[model samples]
Target: MTRGERALLISVDAGSSVPPYEQLRGQLAEMIGDGRLPVGTRLPTVRQLAADLNLAANTVARAYRELESAGLLQTRGRHGTFVAPGRDDAMDRLHRVATDYAAEARRLGVPPAAALALVRAALDATRPG
Candidate 1:
């Protein structure tokens, strides 16, 4: 097993209610959030991971795609995917915070317009006269 995989203990329960792709995605995201999978750490190829886990390649690919979409991973063509770097500067931090909030809003079923309006109102209320 790769150091990252060994540290994260990525696994899938075939009989669990959660889908394999989602299961893999959640574990990877958790590892990334907790720093087990550090930025620039290359991931195993989709085929390789699928074979190791006894899952279809598409399952691993879906997990990787979702992570990439959520800004947790980056694919460098032939080089492969790696954990994305975390934000270090103020604006970058704010952007990450906002992205997290937006994700929460989505999970809570808040409409996109409603979520934006709420943020706007909050900002307006906090603004100096």
Candidate 2:
């Protein structure tokens, strides 16, 4: 299902002790952790989601801000918000390896395009026959 559709599955219970923003944050986080909302999934705009859930824009905005601070979401200018890549140890290790490669490329004065092409070739070489 689409990210927005998955987000729409979240509901707030006004009568419950928990606040709406926290409820929204928790549900979205749970979905992301459980793979229902995978990495790179684009979330709805704050106003759109607020309208969808009958919430104030600030409510959804707060949730988005909190998630972004926690590294669970990333906002790309004009591209909207997306689920940040996983924070699990394996993903962390991969990120570290990629960072090291990028650093080495920078030290060697390799352009980004050339560095990316080298990585792509390595990936292609490792693929199963």
Candidate 3:
């Protein structure tokens, strides 16, 4: 961890419908966008985040992987993860992408229940939605 990098056990509202992984992803994205976690800021390891929140390593890893794939973070071998430069714009882009996907799903005659089921499946299969 970087100097002064206080590892915060990011809080999650138990009553919220959002999954834990999504909460993690969104919070990190927001922090990055708002400069709370500045560009190139090193992040805690997956195990560290999992331990911090009492979550499974896979959960944190999935969120980190998605963020990395979305270009919001970059992982260095054995060094750790860091915020990716120019990733602030990705949060909005991801929202648009989800909207477009939902629209397309509706256009394909996918009923609301089935659509939600697909979303649930995707969320279960990958990171959070």
Candidate 4:
């Protein structure tokens, strides 16, 4: 296993109510979001990862697809998968913070409008005149 794969330490909880794909997806997403998996880091191939984790290839693929849709991972044919690069550093940080905020709001059972209003109010308060 490479340094990146070892650092990944991803696992699927077979006994959990959550599906394996979701568990895998959540872990990988959190790692990418927190920079534990730095941008452009190469990911293990679906087959390889599946073998290592004792999961079906489809499960790993599904997780990868979901993460890709969420802008966390990108796949290049033959070359394999990698953590998606930030198009712009500042925007990337903002996007990560925004994603974190949205997740926390949802976890707290806050209404979407309320969460958005809070963000707007924060931006307004912080904006220079």
Candidate 5:
């Protein structure tokens, strides 16, 4: 399916306590996590998504930025944004688990750098020689 078709499945409730950008981000992330938005899938441009959702461009931009930072999406200059390639189910599980870990770390007042360091240590420890 096309990116616009995928995006059309998402909806925003302005009355919800959750912020609009977060709602968009979560929906996009869920789609990406599933096979619905497979690797290399091209996403709508920020302005295009904003217009479709009736949100300010910055709102969509912020959601895109967050997903990009999380390595779920990548921008290719004029080519536009696309879902980052990954190992399908394995990577999706990893992303979901890592997100949960990060949330737990945040709840426990762990600093971002320290949380990442801990994750790196765990990865190194688990890596095969």
Candidate 6:
């Protein structure tokens, strides 16, 4: 999928366990860190994201506002949101988790596909069981 399309999909999953704002924050943070959404890449407007995600504009705005505060995004007056430059410490935490998971998967000879499936399943099963 194109990068923008994949991000739209992620935005649609906003109603999951973590509140939409945090999900948006975390996902955008990761995308920025991984260089998927390159620095200065224009982001969907708050209204656009809200419409696409079936969320309230205020909700999306809140997330964007938080990201701006954290330095992961910048909003140029009338120009719209753009990916901010720089690495967030959150990326280090994510890398540590990815490294640990990679090591375990290697030890177990788990295929990359299977490992990802497991992670997806875990996310899906986060609700009371």
- For TM-score, candidate 2 versus 5, the one ahead is 5
Residue-level lDDT of model 2, residues 57-121, one tens digit each, is 99999999998987878999787888897578675466457656866886798876898999999
- Pick by TM-score: 5 or 6, better one: 5
Order the candidates by TM-score, highest first: 5, 4, 1, 3, 2, 6
- On residues 18-127, what C-alpha lDDT tens digit does candidate 6 reach at each position? 47776676667667666687777888888888887788999889988987886778899897788777756686477548656855885788876788899889889996
* Model 1 error, position 40 (Å): 0.7
lDDT per model, in order? Answer: 0.80, 0.80, 0.75, 0.83, 0.83, 0.73
Residue pairs with clashing backbones, model 2 = none
lDDT for predicted candidate 5 compared with the true structure: 0.83
lDDT of 6 at 67: 77
**Model 3 alpha-carbon miss at residue 114, Å:** 11
RMSD of each: 5.9, 14.7, 8.4, 5.5, 5.3, 10.4
Cα lDDT over the full model 3: 0.75
**Model 1, 15-121: lDDT tens per residue?**
96568997798778767766677788889999988988999999999999998987888999997888887635564456557758866986898876898999999
RMSD value for candidate 3:
8.4
Q: Highest TM-score: which candidate? A: 5
TM-score of each: 0.64, 0.63, 0.64, 0.67, 0.68, 0.59
Instruction: Output the better candidate (5/6) by lDDT.
Output: 5
Number of backbone collisions per candidate:
0, 0, 0, 0, 0, 0
